[model samples]
Target: MGLFVHGDVGTAASYEPPYTLSSGESVRGGERRLWDNGAACGRRYRLRCLSGSNRPCKDGTVDVTVVDYCRKSPCPSTILLSTSAFSAISKSPSAKINAEYIQ
Candidate 1:
């Protein structure tokens, strides 16, 4: 099981693209590269989650790379992901999640 933190992009700025590193730092071009390589920002992830919601409950797997930055103040960390990223690992959306990071 992964320590998944799930939240709406609108609610959590971390869910935005151009993810801000927890270190309050980032690498130049790192975010763009991830997006250029077919990564989904919050928009894409949300669509996947909504779509997944319509399907039979199962452990859906999606390969998601974080991109951009979510500036919401209440988010625990700047690590943002597409809801599709969460859907890949979670079946329930109503519960709070602690997501595991895949290396």
Candidate 2:
């Protein structure tokens, strides 16, 4: 299992402003609710919508619970993936992501 991050922005409850996270930021918050570097297959991440709104889960920040690894580009090191992480993030359904990892 590898740690995946967000790469792009989209239209979702988490994608709103104020809570929206820019690139190059860790996806961790309080204990128990944290983003790790390892996850299993067919897992689900309990994330918080960065936008923190009641809107639809189009795109936004999330707290992943580590499900499966993504076999895609710029994923292994991505800190903020595209809307695709919705599955892993448990907000949206699925997404086609392109993200950059934080150093």
Candidate 3:
């Protein structure tokens, strides 16, 4: 999974439909696969960090709502977890870590 600061336009989930995140709730942006052509918007997912080299993984899951679409020419990851969400599952928020996510 990848990580992005909430509202950071560069890698933000800026897709349409006007979404807002609940207080204290984790959120993410998904690529085409998870986006499902916008159907994945508002979907919920539970993500667990599997492994990474930079002391990345933590033990437990982070539940996240899909708030936006992640569109990049060469997608970096399936999902881009908000910084807070990434921190919940990994120690290194900037490092890309393998994650197991489910609906």
Using lDDT as the measure, the top candidate is 3
> TM-score order of candidates, best first?
3, 1, 2
lDDT of 3 by residue, 1-103 (tens): 4442232111222122233676444454555766787788777877777777766778887778887666566666777777777788778757777767767
Worst 10 residues of 1 by lDDT: 7-16
Kindly report which residue stretches of model 3 are placed more than 4 angstroms away from their true locations once superposed. 1-26
Each candidate: RMSD to true structure? 11.7, 13.6, 8.5
Give the per-residue lDDT of model 2 (tens digit) for 34-77: 23344232233333333323333334334443322333342333
Error of 3 at 99 (Å): 0.3
What is the per-residue lDDT of model 1 for residues 1-103, given as tens digits with 9 covering 90 to 100?
2233553322111132343443322211123322344343322232122222334334433444343543334444323444444445446543234332332
Task: Give the Å error, residue 17, model 3.
Answer: 18
Q: Which candidate, 1 or 3, would have the higher lDDT against the true structure?
A: 3
When 1 and 2 are scored with lDDT, the better candidate is: 1
Candidate 2 RMSD computed on C-alpha atoms after optimal superposition onto the true structure: 13.6
Judging by TM-score, tell me the better candidate of 1 and 2. 1
Maximum-TM-score candidate? 3
